[model samples]
Target: MTTDELKGLKVASLVDARGTACPGPLLAAKKAMGDIESGEILEVYSSDEGTKVDIPKWCQKMGHDYLGVVEESSYVRMFLKKS
Candidate 1:
């Protein structure tokens, strides 16, 4: 989806991994998925450059819906749907 479309999403959970590196964001996203209901949207805020690729791959492997991302000044915001 477009950045504007993602911005308007109703996120069910948010994982902020801006302070951590590569796997941190992905791990947080994994954990956060347990907290939200199936089909709910999980938003991840990561400063790690690798998370952009890692998350989408993770989502694909995990059978979740990878909603795409939005890159801001310092962080990239990603969205995924729990499966």
Candidate 2:
């Protein structure tokens, strides 16, 4: 998918993966993204430490855009733009 595919996309929902373990956050992100429009953003919140690397890597592998992260003391939220 091209960058244009991800343009004009607003957020659809947030997937909360707090307290979950490896791959859970990514899995939750997938489920959330499935409910959204093709160009929408799916925000994922996770307490898993792997998310710092996993989220962006998953996006790259799937042709999505990693919008960046929002960090809270308890969790990290990642934004992904579907492409």
Candidate 3:
């Protein structure tokens, strides 16, 4: 989806992993996954630069649908659908 489309997603869960680093954001996404059902959307707010790559990779490895990301002034918003 486009960045605008990603920002408009109806998130089932939101994980504010901002200020956290590396595995922190990825771990939060993983942990938060348990709280959402299949097909639901999970929105992750992260500041770590690696998260821009980590999340999509994790989603791929875990078989989830990595929708897209929205870059903010100081952070990024990632969107994914549980599988």
List per-candidate RMSD values in Å: 0.6, 5.2, 0.7
| Candidate with maximal TM-score | 1
Off by over 4 Å in 2: 1-10
How does each model score on lDDT? 0.94, 0.81, 0.92
TM-score of 3: 0.96
Q: Give the candidates in order of TM-score, highest first.
A: 1, 3, 2
lDDT of 3 at 49: 94
Q: For residues 1-83, what per-residue lDDT tens digits would candidate 3 score against the true structure?
A: 99878877789999999989888999999999999999999999999998998888899999999999988999999998999
State the displacement of the C-alpha of residue 4, model 3, in Å, after optimal TM-score superposition: 1.7
Over 4 Å off in model 3, which ranges?
Answer: none
Q: What tens-digit string does per-residue lDDT give for candidate 2 at 1-81?
A: 333343334578878899999878888888888888877788788999888898899899999889887777988877798
Candidate 2 vs candidate 3, TM-score winner: 3
Using alpha carbons, what is the TM-score of model 1?
Answer: 0.97
Candidate 2, residue 13: how far the Cα is off, in Å: 1.0
lDDT (C-alpha) at residue 33 in model 1: 97
Which residue segments of model 1 deviate by more than 4 Å? Answer: none
Backbone clash count, each prediction separately: 0, 0, 0
Residue 69, candidate 2: C-alpha displacement in angstroms? 0.3
Consecutive 10-residue window with the lowest summed lDDT within model 3: 2-11
